[model samples]
Target: MKLTSVSKSLRKLRIPAVLFRRLAVAALPLLLLLALATGCSLFERGGSSAISHKIDQEEDVISSNGGVISNLDKLDSFMERGSGSQRIVQYTIEGDPIFIETRYEGGRLELSYDTTEDAFGPREVKTYSCDKLVRTEEKHQLKYSLKGCGEDMGDGDLLTVDFDLGRQDKFEFILKYGFNHRNEINTVNQNLVKDMLDGTVIEISDYGLPVEDRQSIYRKLVLSNYLGEKQLSTSCNLKPYQSYDLTVLINSAERHYAWSECDTGRDGKVMTEAAEYIIGLVEAGDSFLQLPAATGSVK
Candidate 1:
């Protein structure tokens, strides 16, 4: 039963004023100790039903075992003390799974959600820093107030791409592309290119792209509806002579959207277009052109 329900029952008993005062005094320390043992403030924001259901399941198991606990419940309880530095609260908001995790060691709070598009996809993570957290009960619901907190990251402000290309001639290349809110574009390339005199050489390069080019790439991707595209399933046939793999990640306030196609029988037209555009832009640089062509078959 909830603590509030127990308090209501005690009030209805109409005990003598003096006895009730003494009982309250005696219970204060126990309540404080219970709160400390659980490593959670009594006003922490979370769904009571979810917590109650978990407790009920544990109780059922204990009863089935004749009140003997063979399996210890790791969940925070008065008897099973928890680490006070970290706390995690999980609940659903309008059918979407939401997780709010806080770490007191660094005074950081992370809010994440499982988007409807992909339940198992990477969750979007947003972080904040504050000295304390406050919560209030409203209409039987607990609401958290993150006052004096500073946000560290925002939604749709970070974009990243992973592109892999393999040719029929046993040549492969991988590109890691990053774009930050500051309009910075960075690319890291790892390629096994076929050099005319060297046969094949491993070339690793890291450089920043022009901001103007970054804007162009970002616009093209947005226009192509890149974030809205879903990953296509691969076929069970033998590996193709030439194949492409692409994964694009966009971080948002709610969740991270990851669109990936890995070694599918055929490359997705939209994703391929975006990958090619980025490659073309990179190769346009004089230094990049010095490296053997990452695409096309060996002569």
Candidate 2:
């Protein structure tokens, strides 16, 4: 019998519409078997092709719009489309602003959360072996434990610092707080000076500190109680005239601490001491100075 006639008879039987639709889908394979046995055709010659074409059209729509595969069931298919090379898949969980991103590159998978709510927040990344990821996907169990995946690093570790000295000066300091104990400092339109007596711009870069010097800085930071806690107690005022932004990542605990202030108080004093100590180490002298100071006269 034609599929339409069968549907009409099922409707006459008053079967619940939902149940009837489900039953129809469930019986498709059985009907096909019967049709083959009876030497009959359940669909016209190109019916299956039309259904495949429609599915392809839907997939095209998804691919055009960021290729976000919300349905977990389709994740394998989505990955297949990447042709086993570098690909980035981004998806949101329950419409959250934070996107869960998966990066496939060099036969490894890295998962991270992408968001701007806390731009300086610590980053948590989980890496998985490509073979393990594939096996987990096949088992329909994609939830992996985050513990021991990898250590989360703070943005401060890389010296991702930003200073906004309004109407004072426009310059940049490229600093790298390397993990290998080999740090670097580069400036633009600026210079480091040994002292006011030596008013000469000290051009320096790729400065590597000795172990003792590095330890001295760390001891000062710890003594000031800056690295003792995750959050430091301090009062910050917004001057809108000048601001200092700094983030520090403690490698020992993999913790991140941020300080943003327009005027100095407790936190400011501590940070200043730490900064000067670092500068001293960089200059390898008793005192250090920055020409064309970033601070301006307060209104």
Candidate 3:
């Protein structure tokens, strides 16, 4: 073949020198070193072009999985401590004012609202607005949380609207109070029952609350949906002394302790009323006493 023919044939068989040099410049230093050390096919057939193709494939995979290289720092920060704050503005029905202060604490967010009313007052209301943080696929961003009654309130959240028991049927539950004779004085039960005269036995007897009344009381519990207008935490448990048993049954079967509810700050006015009502019934009737079990711990 003529020299011109041979030159053209060689050009077609090999990558141009400029293109090969560009590939070497574009490849990452570590990858270039690896390709060179291994004498791999990376550069055999337009090696730089092969590297570019591999990079494009990787990028496609990342994009499909909702990954963004720019957000690596943000992703690392999520596993670390994160914090934010939100504010709620409320206006009373009479155009009076109230405010809710929210802050992130521990592992969850806390919200507090004032539930007090003034003399001759129709209460005001405030609505909350904030960017709710959420993770979407691979990124975190603020989502607009709903604003209005019965929305955006997490469990343990108390709104002023919950405080009203107007015409609402009372909750029905049974309570038992027993005297603890043990000497352990530092315990919660001991402190709560200290005022009770020694040997005063409290028990539950034949109690009958209409099913509707029972449902109403159960609904008033925080574990139920209505968290009255406000919730206040106080150490109000009534523990029997060590080795003493006090049993409280809700809905006629679910077992509980009076002091357990008080210590946990879960008791409210309705619960207090129910306890008193149960006491009145016990004073008038006789029921079996549930003696302390072998388990010595006060619930």
Candidate 4:
């Protein structure tokens, strides 16, 4: 009687071993796929978080070092408050050009360096509470101003005349005579004035002049003693309407000089000389290429 009851209980509880094993085998790939997907999701999130953190750190560095402050958040907030004056000063370090912009608003002085192209450059927003004070950047602080600041190269002389003339190796000039001076001018001047409205101003190229002639013209214009004469620095004269614009490419730099009828050096002969030589060339026409180079003092 005991054996019959035990056998009946065993039969009811027993499942097909082969069916259970088959089910487990079928689900194994699915379980492994789910685990791999979870791991990948975590890894992707970690990578994204790391990249974002790195970018934020870089931005912070740039901002702290003369870039737009991240904390300001609003453009208006960065603007200097009250009536302030601004000025820019350019200097060089290690042969690289650097610019400094200083602004004063109300009574506070704010200084920044090389911040933006049409704006300012990278430098801390240095604030000085006093109307006139010194800064830790000793050399620069001395030149600070409440109104404006500029290079105090004594005598107001520029060190260089930097020019950019693109790729062409030629010079073009336009000469126009004022209606009042029209009758006083000579034939060459008359012809130039006539061509002025016709868009036929003279064009001279480097190839047209020999090495000696080229050197002469260059010396006369670039190294001419007249360039350094303080008397030539007078204000531009806009009256009489007579004027000439000369554009040339020298040493890969494009140089331009313009003057009106009454605009002349104190001596009055400097412009007069240059005008005569140039006018002669316009009248030379095609023969100008074969004519001897101009030989005379540039007034």
Please give the lDDT score for candidate 4: 0.35
Q: Once model 4 is optimally superposed onto the true structure by TM-score, how far is the C-alpha of residue 123 displaced, in angstroms?
A: 40
- The parts of candidate 3 lying over 4 Å away from their true place are 1-145, 148-171, 177-196, 201-220, 223-253, 257-299
Model 4 residue runs over 4 Å out of place are 1-212, 226-241, 288-299
Per residue, candidate 4 scores C-alpha lDDT tens digits across 52-128 of 11223211211222111221111122233434433332323222223333345566544444422222333223223
**Model 1 clash pairs?**
124-255, 124-256, 155-252, 155-253
Instruction: Please give the ranking of all candidate structures by TM-score, highest first, separated by commas.
Output: 1, 4, 2, 3
Candidate 2 deviant stretches above 4 angstroms: 1-205, 230-252, 284-299
Q: In model 1, where do residues sit more than 4 Å from their true spots? A: 1-199, 236-240, 249-267, 292-299
Tell me each candidate's RMSD, in Å, in order.
Answer: 19.6, 19.2, 21.3, 23.5
RMSD of 4: 23.5
| Residue 256 displacement (Å), model 2 | 3.6
lDDT per residue for candidate 2 within 36-154, as digits (tens), equals: 88866776543121111122212221211211222232445645653332222222343323333444556444544434322343323333433224313111112322222333522
lDDT of 4 at 257: 52
lDDT of 2: 0.39
TM-score for each of the candidates:
0.29, 0.25, 0.22, 0.25
